[model samples]
Target chain A: MDAITVAFAALYQFGDAFAFLVLSACGLAVIFGMMGVINLAHGEFIMCGAYVTVSGANAGLPLPLAILLGALVSAAVGALVERLVVRHLYERPLDTIVATWGLSLIATQGTLIVLGSTMGGIGTPLGSFQIGGYSYSVYRLVLFVMAIAVLAGLYALFNWTRFGVMARATIQVPHMAAALGVDTRSVYSLTFALGAGLAGLTGGLYAPTMTLVPTMGTTFIMEAFVTVVVGGADVFLGTAPAAVILAIVKSAMTSWQGQLFGQIGLLLAVIVVIRVLPKGISGFLLRERT
Target chain B: MSGKFVRGLRAVALTGTVLLGAGSAFAADPIKLGVLEDQSGDFAAATLGKVHAIQIAADEINKAGGIDGRPLELVIYDTQSDNTRYQEFMRRVLQRDKVDAVFAGFSSASREAYRPIVNQFDGLAFYNNQYEGGVCDANMIVTGAVPEQQFSTLIPYMMETYGKKVYTLAADYNFGQISAEWVRNIVKENGGEMVGEEFIPLGVSQFSQSIQNIQKAKPDFVVTLLVGTPQASYYEQAAAANVNLPMASSVNVGQGYEHKRFKPPSLKDMYVTTNYIEEVDTPASKAFVAKFKAAYPDEPYVNQEAENSYLAVYLYKQMVERAKSTKRDDLRAEIAKGDVCMDAPEGKVCLDPKSQHMSHTIYLAKVGADHSITFPKVWEDIKPYWLGEAGCDLTKSDPSEQYTPSNPPSKS
Candidate 1:
């Protein structure tokens, strides 16, 4: 392949991982990173979002509106779940893992029994465009753009907004925030809802590019977990850079060798990063500032 | 005290006498068979239809006065799409339920998992799903299309219609690996060249890199041996990328009814060769489809596995009647006799006495944008000789091994 072909291939590969990580982990980053509560049902939240989009679109709403509705539905569900179950186990992170895992099972099997195994998913909009001799899907590029926008939007929300500032403060010291009359309980619930809403948006955006099934979330969850863990507790700065690094490594490795080696390169990069940097790429960046 | 104890004993004796009388009132007990399937997980889409088809067949048999005045009873269990559960439930079906025969196992690995237990119990394990072929065992019967019947018919047609250069993508498993080998053989036999081949790990859904690589290679057509719910996403991804190359797969659309699940243009123009498709224009197939549709009005579609499952029940019934008993040893001997055959909805299906694989008709089908299948060519009674080619003759000797490719493709 020529240099331009190679470049385009690399770009597409990068986009693939970047989009996957950003969308899947953005929600997980908030729930796991900020709250220190392992939400094993994070993937199920995405699944719910996908289902919402399909149902909404089928129910005569426009596609974009359907996607927005999906996110809102997920947010509502996240809030309800937080109020009902997660609120009781705020300090118990391990317990949250077990609880969320059970929730995931119920969600998965319930979908299977209710919706049936195979439901038709929407087709990917936008046709393909050629770069040099290679053709690429416009939908894939849309995912990449969406991932960046989500990252930026998240950064602005957490860094600029009063709610973001209050959330960060609440997470840093719940008792202090509570004493300051900032209702730590509400903050936790809203933060979890925000995270879950992001996961829903991810699912709605991705529902078109893949076949939708009750078990579709399993495909995205592993990579999401890896990206989040490798990125560390700092949601925006950590997850963005982590996605980039992992995407580039995976894309390049896949192009050079094959799919198996590409995946190995990703896992190996994570292992090496977790071992060497302990606190992840963001931690190392923070320590450098000191 | 003596009078009270005697009165209690008399009551217990009366209860026992009534229970025994009720038990013997039914002239013959039902012939119990085990039905193991994945009802709620990854394999559910492909396997659930087969489970329902089994039920329909058993119900039909019982309605027809059953075999020798004995009703056919199915002890069904959902394996939950877990391979470990296959063995656990197989043990239950064999030892606990003590079923005469078993109709289970969707994937090749799942079959291998439960085969040992079935063999130990001398139980007849009937698998009805398209496979990579080359399995030689007397305790098991494969009533589904194999690579030999599928690729032998489809590959040459693909090569002729498209070109000699082919690219292969398969799931990274025993079935995928073995099936890819057969693709290589067929491509070579038909004077084609395999330009690129990749074995993808199961559940790796993202295929942008792989799609781009295929575009770079620029093969005339692609042969996908992908399996499972996740791997099916490749077609959607590929379609999105506008990789317009023709693709042939025996694995994808037909068995899982992927055509119905996926949006059009993704599966459109895709080629599939199988023993049965819902759109076969034959009178027998039409009648079967009508009955199946009436029976399962809500099912997405009655797939090849479902048809095979329906056939397996009748085939077993034939063997039972031939043996004149439901004993495992007698059933095995009857199966070995090689006189078992069924005029199934798919076509005439008969067991290859040597390999215990079914010999049936194969049809070449193309998927329309609307997910309707159209059969262009149908080959009748294509024996699964791929096992014979591998020097497996179970008629002469009982060998326990899965025959692999004689000349495997070189790892790139």
Candidate 2:
């Protein structure tokens, strides 16, 4: 292969990896990083999004509209979960983990019972373009763009909007925010819903490129969790940079060897990052700013 | 008490004893066939049809007055696609229920987990799924096609149809690994070169890197031994990337019915070699499909594994009738004679008595743009020649081992 072709391939691999890590961790950045709730059921929310999106698309809705419907439905479900289950366990962060974990199991098996094990998946839209002899998916590149859009949108929502201000205040100090007439309870619910919606968006976007199984969320869960852990609590400051670093490591390893080594290199990088920076990348960034 | 009362009691007692004796004399014991399959887990969708097929076979035999008036009773257990469950339930069916025989397992891992237990009880068991091959056990009967039957037909045809350069992507488990080995050897033997080979871990959905790698190698065609829901995504991703190279497999559409599950154009131009698919156009196959559909109105596809299991039940009934007994030793002896054959939906399939494996009629099927299947070639009576050549003669001795290309059996 020519050097130009090699460079394009390398760039494509990095972009794919970056998109994957960023999208998988985006929702968790809000729920776990911002809200201080460890949701083991995060994957199920993604599964829900994918299921709804595929069902909608099959029912004759346009693909983009189906994806939007997926995100909305997931947000509604997330809001309901916050009200019924998450509201009771906010003080006991550890208990919230167990509760959400139980919820995940029920949701997964329930989906299996209702929807069966497999569903007809939507075909990936858009065609492919070739660079030299190598061909690449236009849809995958779209995913890369989508990942960037989601991150930038989240940053704007939290930093620039009125709802974002109240949500942040509530997360930082629930009692103070409530005293200040912020309706802390409502903020909490909306924040959780936002997190879940982002997760659903992740699912809907990749639904076409994957086989729609009840357990398909697991494919994203590991990478999602790892990225979240390495990114730390700050979604804006940590998530984007962490994804870039990890993506670079993963793509380089994948290019040098294969996926197995790439995965090994990813986990090894996580361990090293955690050891050197205990609170994560965002924590380090926050410390540097101080 | 009056004399009339005493006479009445004695008569009643006599009638009761006679009725009990008549019941014992006329009605025979039901022959229990243990069925353990993945009915609710990862493989539930793919293997549920097999469980239903077994039911259909058993019901047909019972409807026909069974074997010499002994009803065929199914002792069914849903293993839930878990290996530990296979162990737990295999023991339950064998030791507790004392089932006459068993037709069980979907994956090779589950089979390996419980096959030893079946042997421990000296029970007759049939593993009815296409696998990596080279399992030679006296107490076991494998009705599924092996690498010898699958790859022998698939690799040469793929090479001739596509080109000399091949790329292989397989699941990391034994089935995929061994199958890939067969692909490599067969490709070389056919005077073709394997440009690249990669083993993908189970549950991985992303394939951009793998696709890019395949493109880099520029193989004329690809061989995918991918298993499970996640690996099935490779087709969709590859298609979207415009990798127009044709693909061939021994698994894929035959077992999982991927063509029916995935959208059109994803699986287009893919070829698979198998003993049965729902699309196989034969009177017997059509009848079987009709029966299966009638039994399960909502079932999407009647897969190859289901057909294997369905035929296995009938094969067992034939064995019992020939031996005139359901005893393990009697059936084993009858099987050793090597004349066991069943006219199944996939045409005539015979158990190779020497190796205790099946000889299947392999069909080469292609997926169209609309996801419809068409048979382009057929190889009849393809025997499990590899095991027999590797000295796996159950008639002479019981090896009770699975041999691979890396681990050949020691010639005695």
Candidate 3:
């Protein structure tokens, strides 16, 4: 009975870790899946959003309003960054990597300077709640809901909206879309902004769990890359399944000393998979790109 | 007439900008002390006390009519507690702003990131935290308790009290590994057999095998050289699993999680070894405690990190006054002399007069309810691992001074 209880407790603990993984995957899908841009600046976009929310909240703004402003600010910054910096680096993989890397640093430090302090955390109301004789995280449940909404909204936008249709068409055949009198450049810009806005929304929502810091993006960004690349960049929803699988596998690896090994193992496995199947694990699962 | 006026105005504007720039450069500024620490990142929660302590010290110093009548201006950078950010903070402090001295950071990772930079710039950095020791440099002053301070007190306390076979749990990095090594040596040397040892990753949540191994061994006590979320969750789960075994001494267990992990009431009687405690029954310590609680009522009690950082500021003040110069070489020489004492919790914490490291007092405390812990007595004037029983003389009136190498600090 004691062993059963302990196992249940461990499961609950792991469930909390899984919630963050899901959040990271939610951000990764759009940047990698829909628009097909390897956004190195995605993490910066998240960091900017988190910092903006913190600054906004610090300035005595309401929580919901701050979050909206944070996402908007992140999108504007993302749009400006894409226009001035990432736009030039398009089709140049090596150049984009260097450029986006610089942009991440600048965005992180710029936020730090503007905030003028190191510490930032939202006043969240997440307490452990027991349901049906089992412990569950209230905030984790909220995060799950938020991610679903974002995912659903994203699916609807890509399928039902004209702008999103143009985006998908351009993503599928940029030359053909251009020939059909579609402004592909503007589509790219808007798609990039949309991707950044989602990343920001994720960050703003995630800020309550972890405290805000300048380089907080470093961890989340790396996790985003891992999720997007391994989950399959072609399928918009692959990151969801990828995150679930990653979280469960990590849950099982608790006996392997620590979560760090689990993380390292995940990275290692991703590397091996990428080497063997350059198209990612999702490639084998999803026969078609769309 | 328009062209002539525009040219004249442009020249005046250019001259004004240059003058403003040059004027601010030489503005008889107060010596800037950079207080770099993890403010709002992973390590920030654990390191907040240390940063707060620096602020309190700076406030006190200013109230004391400033260092030699020139107020010390503290310019703090939040490394957001990231190792990479720490490097940037180091660059900004040493390369660009060029602070007179830096009193920043805790933990081995942050120290490792900042040490090379400190050496490269030959800038003085006062490291203020207890660490697994075994490093020395000219440009750095370690004011915190060393491995000798932490282990020597705690090891003796654990060995004498329990007399059980020892198994160790530590964080897996240079500091953690070194801490485990020290425990192994102390246990073996002091007539105890270690059944096993394990290293947990910095941010891990799993400790099943470790606990299973511990159950098999059933050692007298476990010493947690671990920190952050890993330590917290492991203890919580371990406790729930009835692995409610006590630690002989938890190095990273004080405010880090000593009171945090327990259920309705926090874990009682968790033995911890640290240099400073909030419950010290001293006039100076009491005042410091009151001041802190009043200033940041929502904040937690004083951890060793804060006390050390606070000491670093005062340490700089004393050194600067004694040396009478802001020159790096002169300040280093003054601190090397080690003739310093202030109203600190340790009651006159000072340097080694030679190695430039502080061999401050280390106390053993047990936590209680109401989020307060008490220290009965500390091993005062504790002999460091580097310092033997017979004592080593640092100052020698010999021909060594003949070199007069033009460097005030010899970096011995």
Candidate 4:
């Protein structure tokens, strides 16, 4: 392989790792990082999205529309969860972990019982393009762009939108926000739903590239948690940088050795980040600014 | 008064005797067979069909008046793809239920988990899944295709057709690890070079780096020993990336029916060696598939292991009949005679009493671009050659141990 091909391959690896980390972490970053709820059922919401997407596509809906329908359905489910279960445990963030963990188990087993263990998967869309001698998936590049778009869209929503202001206010101080005429409950519900919707979107997008199984969500959970933990409590500020750093570390090690070392490199990076920053990347950034 | 009382007592005694004779003629104790399989977990997709196949076998036997007038009753337990559950259920079936025989275990780990318990009871057991294939236990009968049957045919054919350079991608477990070694050995024996090999941990779905590595190596063919739902995605990713090298496997199309599950062209140009597939067009296989479908109208596919499980039930029946009893010692002695055989759906398969393993007729199945399967080659009467080479002669001595290539028998 030429140097150009090697460079393209390296770039491709970085993008793939970055997209995976960002997509997996984005939803959890919002739910656990921003909401302080430690929602362990985040992965199930992703599964719900993937399941709905595949079902929709199989039912003859177009792929993009199916993905949209998946996100909407996951959002609605998230809203319901927030109202029925998560609402009671908002004051006890630790309790939310246990409750959401229970919900995840219920969701996984429930999916298995209802839909069986396996489902036919959608074929990955778009063909490959040759780079020198090696071929690369066009859909993977699309995923990279989608990750950036999601982050940008989220940034706009939280910084520019009126609802974002209310959500942030509620998250910061629920009683104070309520006193200031913000319906904290609705903000919390909408924010949680948005988080879940993003997770669902991640699932929908990658559904084609993966085997559809009830336990598929577990595949994303570890990456999601590690990214969110390293990202800290600011979804926008922490997640992007953390994803970049971790993706670079992972892809480099993967290129050097293989996936096992890549994973080891990833977790080691996380440990170092946590040890150095203590409160995480965003927390350090916030302190530096103050 | 004495005469009347005596006459009444005689009449009552005669009625009781008649009723006892009627009951004895109608009901007999069922011959219990324990079935342990993953019905609803990770391995459920593949092993669920095996469970259904076992059910069909039991039903058919009972319909034909059962084994010597005793109904074959299945005491089934769902192991849920957990190793601990296999041990727990094995004990329940062996010690508590005292089942006459068992057909169980999906993975080598599960088999290893429960084999000791089976041995402790001196019970008869059948491990019916294709595995890394070096187990030598007196209490267990392995009906699945071993490496000698699978790789010997597949690797040589792959080398002759594809090229002399092979790359291996295997799941990082005992099965995949050992299977990779077999692939290496077979490739070398065929005068092919193992250009590259990677052991992927379970649940690592991302494969960009692995793909790049394979592309860089530019092997003539790739041998994938991937297992479970996560690793199966490699096909999709590889296809999307246009990794156009031919792929051969021992456990792909036959076990998970990847060609059926994945969309067209994902599994295109893939080859697999196995004793059975749902696509086997033989009359016996067709009838067996139809029977399984009839029993389980909603079953996805009748996998390779299901065939082993199906034939194992009949094989067990043969052992029982030959012994004229279901006692472990009697069954062992009968099986040791080396005459137990069954006209399995795959073809004629016989238990090799020396190794306690089945001799299988293997097929080389090729998956088409449109997800169709065609058998281009067949190898008949392939014995567990590796075990034999390792001197795993159960008739001579019961070592009750697994022999890997690196850990061959000392005597050998």
Candidate 5:
């Protein structure tokens, strides 16, 4: 067996996986936790966000501006979906899942008709930053920062604002909250939109780091699902931290074993976590829910 | 010969995100090549190898002042290894980016889906991965060896080198079935016997049935064409079962599916045919591998999908330079000339003038225990074994079996 390089390289890979995990998990949980919808189409929304960025750049828009346009477009799309499709599905989780899944399939197929069966890249429009030997793509670091900031902002939205308080009450006890004069329906719509907006933000953020594709979101979604599930779907806020831990663990696993064994081992870990901590580590975060 | 199909690809994409600014072709602007591949799906590992090929090609072209003094810009998107998404991503490149040309995908299903799309768009498509052949069209050049190219050489080689009996397993899709028919035909033609021919669905698990059958049949060589995550599970189960295959080969086995999923003994010593095996010698290939290794310091080279995309970018640059124009049709016409030489590790890229399908040299090799291949003949220019007359007339049977392998063994 080769001598495992348990050095700084391990830390770098761990950091990368950690960044990806935290962002995607937080993104998904924000949608699922606040919205209470499985939102299978969440991944497609991410891809759409990537396309929006690419399209804007193709139109000669500045990189930062193009990405902004992408996020705005993605948010608009999410908001529209919420207003149109998701709003109606309030109070129904399973229905939302099936409906969103259908939307995902249609959107993917629609993208196929639009993009053709090929992949493309957005030039590394941003600069880079080197930490030791690992020259991390500058955009990736920026995205990581943005993800953390967004998580904090979203935290503020929940803990520090009246909207957050109402949203929390609605999620915790809709019947009682409604009896107490909370407008649960609007809250559902607002939360779903916010979740989608986050997904769009992820797409926009990931665009520069990744090659744009319609199905790219699926890969992110799979990991995000594991993270959201393992993080505690109930705590809703536990999504990012849980996702980060799992991502780092997976990254470490891949660095130790090749990505092949790493993936299998991580998958096994996810299954085990799901089995043991069914609601995820977030269950620990939420004393009220537990 | 025809422009109808190519036009349809444009129609689908042109409807929405079409790049309307009709900027005249200028040397100042980079000659863009859209590289559509699956970066993060079941095929990600397999497709990852092509990225180096793409980057190296881009650098080489740019070093040479690109097409008519313009630098070549490579735009890549992940298909997530999904055919439907592959089509969508391709459309964005052509209609929106309006790239000079496009190189895309690692699977035959994706190629098939993109065929009509490419036809309608009338833009160049470098379909770089090996797959089952048959559907030929304009604006699309199938770079990887077709069924005829791969199966004809491997079947005869297997029968002559190994015993005459053969066992075949392939995914039950357009790519697999078409290639499977050709394999069966090649064996019959070669005077060898085929013991069994099995077709598994794309994601079907529970390979005990197929594994047991192959063992019971006791074929001299077991040829496989399965791909994706399911393949990993199949290999693991087969390894666990301890069913040592007589001798096996595949056009689709090097996709990194077997690397992390299966153990050492599994699929070892298996002979395989590919346009690329990492061991092929070349400075360009070396640079590509080096850069890729640098990029993903901890990860092993992914596979052909990335390499093909790399080749696609270079091929586009070569064609555009030869044509001295990036006005779509002119480059497509030059590619149609089919005589472009690629500075490739797998020798020269032999383009088919009529179909624009570049028939490059294929490598014949055997896999080692550590999931690496040792290519004996890294560059072998096997003639166009397009299975011309041997191809079952699709008009006869929708799911036809008109194939006749050269070495006809008694299938169990």
Candidate 6:
């Protein structure tokens, strides 16, 4: 590969990792960061979204609308799950973990039984363009943009919206927020739904770029969990910075070494970050900001 | 009155015992066939349909009055795609259930884990999945195409059709690694050049760097030995990037059925060689396909693995009939005597007596824009006899060693 092509490849690799981290981790960050609920079923939510996109696209809906519907359906399901199960397990972190893990298994196996283990996937729309004698997909660029947009949208929703304030207040001090006449219960449900909804959107977006299998979530869950863990409990400050660091480290290492070392590099970075700053990168940032 | 009732009950019990004895005398013991497959988990995508295919074949045999009036009883267990589970269950099926023959294992790892257990217990195992090959065991009957059988036929044709430059990508495991070596050997043998080669870790979904490298290498065609669910993403990623070079693969369509899984045009312009594809329009294949569809109307598609499983069950039946008994020693003796060939969906499938591997017709097919397969040529009865060339003689009854590439290509 020529120097320019190598440069372009590196850029593409960085973007790929960034988009992947954002897509897989952003939703879990919401649940784990704000609500302090470890959602082991986060991957399943993403899988559900992917399935919806595939079904919707096959049913003749336009690609964008299908993606939207997939996200919405995931959110609806998330809301329902939160109401029926998660609501009862609040403040019981260990119980929530077991509950969500069980939910993940049920969702995965249920999909397998109902939809079969594997299904045909939708073609990724938009084609490729050449740069420096290298062909790069426009759809990949779309993912990069979508990742940034999701982050920006979530930031605005949390920082500027009234729902965000109530959610923040309810989560930080539920008794006080409830005493002040805020419906803490509804806030928890909405926040959880939003987290799940983001995961669904990620799933729908990448559905076109992957084969649809019931166990697809397992592929994404490891990275999601790692990123969330290293990012800490602060959604914006910790998760975003951690994602960037990890993505850069991963992309560079992947290009330099093979994928195995790239993953190893990511894990090493996570360990180093956590050891240096026990609360994660964002937790350090929050302390400094405060 | 009590004495009379007791005498009547005694008479009835004696008559019932006599009738039960008569029934036992008339009905023969069923031949137990053990089937272990990954119905759920990572391997489910490839092995689930195979379970159904095994069922259909067993049902067909039972309906045909089984082997000489003795019914065939299929005892199946789900291995959940785990090698440990496979090891655990293979033993259970053999020792506890005492199945006459075992038809199981999918991945090369799973096969390797269970191959010895089958031999240690002096059991009959028929492994029927296309693998890296070169396993020669007396107790095990391998019914899949090996690297030489698949790639030797495929690479030469690909070189003739496209140019002599090749780029290869493989999964980082025994099957992928061995297949890549064979690819290298074949490319060298054909006077072709291998411009680039890479081994991808399984479950690495991102392929941007690999794609870039392929473009940089500018090979005439790319040959991927990539496997599993995550590896299937390469097609979509390649398509999205418009990597327009023609590609040939031994893995893609056969096991995972990626041709049917991915949307059209993604797998378009790719070539694959396998023993059976859904598009094998032979009368036998078509009939089998129709029967399968009739049995399970909602089945998505039947690929080579399912067909191979179906063929394995029938091949075992053929062995039993030839031996005239379900006894393991008799079956082994019959197999060792050679000439275990039967007509299958993919044409005549024969067991190489020397190597315990299969010899069968291979179809070189291409993916259409609509996800249908089009066979350009059917390379008939290609004996993987080269496995014997690798110095494995099953007739010697030595199951201690496996064959590996003697002259692996130099890493470029």
**Better by DockQ, candidate 2 or 1:** 1
For residue A216, model 5's alpha carbon misses the true position, in angstroms, by 15
Which residue pairs of candidate 1 clash? none
Judged by lDDT against the true structure, how good is candidate 5?
0.64
TM-score of 1: 0.94
Tens digit per residue, CA lDDT, model 2, A56-156: 99999999999999999999999999999999888777798899999987887798878877899889999999999889999999999999999999899
Q: What is the lDDT of candidate 6?
A: 0.83
Model 1 segments beyond 4 Å from truth? A281-290, B1-26, B407-412
State the lDDT of candidate 5 residue by residue for A144-263, as single tens digits: 577677777877888889999998888778888899999987886677667766777777766654434456676677777777777775333576667566766666555444344445
- Model 5 chain B: ten consecutive residues of lowest lDDT: B393-402
lDDT of 1 by residue, B1-412 (tens): 2558645644543332111111232368778778888887888888888888888887788777776777787777777788887887788778876888889889888998888888787788889989998778878889999998999999999898989999999999899999999999889988899999999988888899899889989999999889998888888888888898888998877777778877788887789998987878789889988888888888887788999999998988888888898875677676678767889888898887778899989989998877788887889999988776566777777666777787422223
TM-score of chain A of 1: 0.95
- Model 3, span B27-102: residue lDDT tens: 3457777777776555655677776777777777766666776676676666665787677667767876678988
Error of 4 at B391 (Å): 1.0
For model 4 chain A, give the 10-residue run with minimal summed lDDT. A281-290
Position B366, candidate 3: lDDT? 68
For each prediction in turn, the share of the native Cα contacts (below 8 Å between chains A and B) that it retains comes to: 0.74, 0.81, 0.06, 0.76, 0.00, 0.81
DockQ of 5: 0.02
lDDT of the structure predicted as candidate 1: 0.84
- Residue B275's lDDT within candidate 4 is 98
Off by over 4 Å in 2: A281-290, B1-26
Tell me how candidate 2 scores on lDDT: 0.87
lDDT of candidate 2 over B338-360, digit per residue (tens): 89998999999998977888999
Poorest 10 consecutive residues of model 1 chain A by lDDT? A281-290
Docking class of 6: medium
